[model samples]
Target chain A: MVAAPCCAADDCIIEARGLTKEFSGFVAVCNVDLRVRRGHIHALIGPNGAGKTTFFNLLTKFLAPTRGQILYRGEDITHAKPAEVARRGLVRSFQLSAVFPHLTALENVRIALQRTHPGTFHFWKREATLAVLNDRARELLELVDLGAFAAVVAVELPYGRKRALEIATTLAMDPQLMLLDEPTQGMGHEDVDRVTALIKQAAAQRTVLMVEHNMHVVSRIADTITVLQRGQIIASGSYAEVARNPLVMEAYMGAPDGELRGGH
Target chain B: MRAQPVLYSLAVLFALAVPLLGIYPVFMMQLLCFAMFACAYNLLLGFGRMLSFGHAAFFGFAAYATGWLVSAHGWGPGFAILAGVAAAALLGLVIGALAIRRQGIYFAMITLALAQLVYFVCLEAPFTGGENGLQGIPRGTLFWLLPLHSDVVMYYVVLATFVAVFALIRRVVHSPFGQVLKAIRDNEPRAISLGYEINRYKLLAFVLSATLAGLAGSLKALVFGFVTLADVQQSTSGDVVLMTLLGGTGTFFGPVLGAGIVVTLQQYLSDVVGGWVTAIIGATFVACVLAFRRGIVGELTLLASRARRTLRPARG
Candidate 1:
């Protein structure tokens, strides 16, 4: 029950001190000391099996870290439930389970707003009370450029629109720090651009820590970048600095033999 | 949607005319009780997406409670029924807490095992009468004022209770909490990440479903003047599942229709085919699964929407 040591820097919203996760004998995330500055877009990029998702899971409390502590806003939330962490305004948009498919885009966002609403437990209240949230849900949908699909079920929307709807739902939670895992995975060039724009707009008012395979989107939007290899942080600095780092180049291209290309 | 109210009114009018046409009132009462049981099961299966194989634990336990109060303690029908419902809801809370720890098929299996445990408890318990059950329980008047000695009066009372409970179920389905329940059903992880303590919502829905099932069970005890171990048996649980699946899992009128069809088939089939009644029901369930996976009402909705689509003029 000891409190985690807080960072002296006032801008550090999230600090992970030697966070490690092991499944049986093999380590998935190893002693990764990390700091995420407030109101900055932080990107965690790694090759396949580098444990970016495993690390994200630990920070979100979806999985208990095998070792070390996680500090959120200077408070130790290492043992909190996903819902408890979310209630404190640190929320996550999952890979696939980020949106309710059967619910319409508007209804999906409405449920997020309803979570923080006082009348969530009022089963007997008139539907009018719920109708009052429609305007705000629609506003979020518009923000994600999903205004036309407001009435469509999340499942019926195209893959990119589904991703947009997920973002809208996450935005409805009004989170202080939004953790997005693979925000642009499996997308066409157009969708990747659209989601990249959405992420940039979202990061304006809140901190975002995203794990992305598409380094182009990350380089464009991320203010700070942390690169991992073999479950260990290889480099941590500004996006330009991480991109130019020889270690990161070696991890992505098998060896640091040539200059980095194509991602720009 | 516009045709819904007209359809509902017609159905109510038909229910009223059944007893007057000299149809057996007791048979109709059984249908009402079973219909309510299926609706309660449907609440968990259709909306919550949590299949509970042990719902008979709630229905059967309440029947025994009502039977004991009326026959042994001389309690009035209203108070006895209320007490039975409260006990069943408490049981639901305990069972739901345990069962919700698992997901999918495991949840169903856990509920089934717990229900079997309850069955054994009823078999060994003293006041349940084990094999004999509580027999010849009196159907006391409502509030001790209206006389329920007449079959016609009892028919009206059961019908009234059925309608009130049906309205309650309808209210819950359309409410905001119901929206949250549907969201949980569609995706549990998303609901949790949205900051909903989904286990609480699941348990609340379970308690409400159990309470309604209890109401149906208590009513059945008064109507038949008996409670048997058969009421709480695993077979009874299967019957409710069959009725719900046959009617349509998520539709409003599906369970009622399924209950009516199953109850009538059982009654007349037992008179003629005797031991083949189970076989006949088994065949019907197989047919339902193979030919009409969406059940009766679900098919009707599909057809209606199709018809509307065809009737509309094609846009240029």
Candidate 2:
């Protein structure tokens, strides 16, 4: 396989200005501004209640932003439905483990490929795109190193494998921007590092904005990091710079450098 | 070992055995109608994981449309069946588009309410022949003179329709579209994130299910030479769901077996228990729900999987 030509153009692929999300007087994300450039693996890190997931929901149109403007490729997408937003080359993975549990991993990828191309209502004649579809799905599964388990039911996979399959399935759509919520949520250190590497590989072709809590993983994979606290951006900078920020320290309960136990 | 061809042969042998056994043709025709109904209903429930509560709207509505087409305009049975199927497809399109606005229990309720509305429409429509229904209809031939009046021939006809529709469903469930429908059922959010227009797939599934149910109903009316308000009744809808669920929700051949069992049980119970048949069917539904959520086919498949594993060495 050829390497994806990395084109970190530094132009904002996703721009959020004054974004806010509230539910019945509870502010989940408040007045946050974020800019993610094309082909950059950006990470958002915060404490449990920092509203990273809420912000992701807003950006992907899973939930309505209380108030904000989300510009993707310089056009507004603040109010588009999830499908419409996805059709515009923006897709998101779920934080709480979203996947088709019954389908095989390869089948899952194939279905995603099928959805991307023509619909499945071809009532007569063989689907002309079958060979290409199968190959594309196979290529994605191999990228995630899930080629061995391609025919295994996704639900039957180990947690790490399932996470990898989730990422693989999303990547098969060839999105211009990928929003992943907690991609390494329950992974072991080795699995986390492996997935972080895989995420970097995927980011070679498109922009990747991820939500995470592991500082070391963030440091290794993210070109830039945003720290949020109480639904607000507390700090934003390079990994080394954010590590020294006093606000980042305070947000991590006064632990210097915002490092957690069991972190490499 | 390789049991697929043997199983296929067995199924074919059994289907062909119906005529040789000297069975009553009308009884087989009734079974065939319900079989198609269960299979079409199962297309959504088994594969789509959507248990529709108002299938009668399609089944009975098509029956009425077919009755109207044949009696009012003196159309042939083939054209009547086509008109009924078209009407059912349109109904499925409208109802599926609306019902899919929500998922889970809400989807079922929305379909039921829409079916009730259809029931009310049938009640008021002048062509429906009111409560007495459109009776004295001719049991028209297939095309011109296939002579559908012979009981054995009509029985074979019904059987053929049942087999074709069932095979088509089997073909569909294994197809890419079916794979996506299953994926959507298992995880809607993941499917949408993967770029599926979730509602469109769902609506198309609904329409397909509705149209096939219509085909079965249209054929049933032709075989019996009568259509009535009972076809449009709410109970008719509930019966199809019960039939599918009782046989199996996830298995391909489950609905076929389910419809056969339920119809046979109805026939046997009518002879032994008379008016208490409905109560018996209701009791069966409750039993199946409580004890067999996987239904007969799913449970059998589960058992087969378990057996396969047991016969093999454990993998580390």
- True interface contacts retained by model 2: 0.56
lDDT of each: 0.89, 0.84
Clashing pairs in 1: none
List model 1 lDDT by residue over A1-264, tens digit each: 454445455688899999999999999999999999999999999899999999988998889999998989888888889889988888888776478887889999999998767767565666567888999999999999988998887887889998888988988989999999999998889999999999999999999999988878887899999998889999999876887889988998988877555373
| Candidate 1 residue spans exceeding 4 A from truth | A1-8, A259-264, B310-316
Model 2 clash tally, residue pairs: 0
Q: What is the lDDT of residue B48 in candidate 2?
A: 86
Tens-place lDDT digits, model 2, residues A27-133: 98999999887878899998888898889988998888889888888777777788888878898999877768898888878877787566476543243445568
- Which candidate number would show the highest lDDT if scored against the true structure? 1
Tens-digit per-residue lDDT, B1-316, candidate 2: 3665687679877767877887777888898898899999998988887778899999989999998888888998888899999999999999999999988899999999999999888888999988888786676787896677787878877888888897888777776677778888899887777767788888878999999999998988887888887887889888888888888887777787888888898888899999899998999999999998888887887888888888776653
Report the alpha-carbon TM-score of model 2 versus the true structure.
0.93
Clash pairs of candidate 2?
Answer: none
In order, the B-chain TM-scores come to 0.98, 0.95
